[model samples]
Target: MKKEEKLEIKLNVQKESWKSLWLMARRYGMSPEKMLEQFVADLTCGAGSGGSDERDLAERWYYRSFEMMGEDTFVSYLCSDEDMIEEVMELKGRITKSEQYISEVKKRIETGERIFVHYGKADKKSLIAATWEELGYESREAWDKECEEEIREEKEIVSENEERLKEIWENFQRARASQSATYEEEMKKLDEFLEEYGKSFR
Candidate 1:
């Protein structure tokens, strides 16, 4: 694919199960990641309906039927008047510049380049601080404080969502089961009444 080519592509994506993505990836001689990007591009680049909420629509188009691997996100666009190549390069530069902080702060994440793993266990903050120190800046007390607060907020949101979802699902199941039980009991009573009426008629 030329970095500067502006062309429309149509891609058929197998949903979150990722079974079809893997197959397409192999067929295209590219990684599953590359296949997924092509799939998202074709979907969100206005090749088709493009749907509402492009990002969510892309996720659905790619994996609604499949199990979620994780909640990764993507952003795509259609070039209106600007040069697409320049836009792509500028976007890439923006991302790379942000990521440069990773090497300065931490390295080799998951065997490639280390990542700052702040799962927010008690030593996580210290490790992040050390990464900043390596980058020739003492980890700022203010920033560290902000990070801790942010981490706490994240934990609260996750915990709240989990509880809310669980409560709603449990209530749904109970309602279903209760209705089933009531229906069965009613059927049993109807059958008994019919048996008595038949005996009287005889």
Candidate 2:
């Protein structure tokens, strides 16, 4: 029989995990590298070299079935990672909530309400109701004027709130600094809180 060529491969893992693995190897009376090699060999002992190719082909067809059926494709995408069932449920829940919100927004628009949309720090905008006639406006010019006025009023309200927020932020900074000996730690906590809050919108 021909001798199999052995190759060395470096595996990067967390420091604590690597230490624990070495401890386990010591307990088993084997070098860490040998233990890992044997562990992997045991895992694939029954699989021939063609096994991976066959597995890949099977997976391809399994996914292709979902693609062929348009209706099931979306469901498959949502359930793609079976290990992350909770994440999938959360995504489905968000979709349901969004559908409900869109229905409400549609009704509001039908009733001649402009749906305001905030885009980052840009000028305020809105989805103007369908048409002048549908929105009960006498003319397109009148509808346009009303939209401009409403948008302008909303911008002014936003500007006022921004100024109020600036003042409140300054006061908050002073208060937080005065209350905490670890002012930097307090600020770091605030940063963490803002990051989590922003993630909710995403």
Which predicted model would earn the best lDDT? 2
Clash totals for all candidate models: 9, 0
Every model's TM-score: 0.21, 0.25
lDDT tens per residue, model 1, 1-202: 6565454556565576577667778996888876556555656664343346765666665556644542211111111223532433344344445445443333332232222343334464555556555534365554455544554555555555545534543453454443333434533453454355346433
Instruction: Kindly report which residue pairs in candidate 1 clash with one another.
Output: 16-63, 16-66, 17-66, 107-114, 108-113, 108-114, 109-113, 109-114, 109-115
Worst 10 residues of 2 by lDDT: 70-79
Global local distance difference test of model 2: 0.51
Q: CA lDDT of 76 in candidate 2? A: 26
User: Per-residue lDDT tens digits of candidate 2, residues 1-202?
Assistant: 8866665667889999989999999997988887667545544442232356655665566557756654322222223444433443343345445555555545544554442332234333323434456446777567556655655555555555445534544554554443432435543454454355446534
TM-score of 2: 0.25
Task: Report residue 100 deviation for candidate 2 (angstroms).
Answer: 19
What lDDT score goes with residue 197 in model 1?
Answer: 39
Off by over 4 Å in 2: 1-135, 172-193, 197-202
Misplaced by over 4 Å in model 1 are: 1-141, 178-202
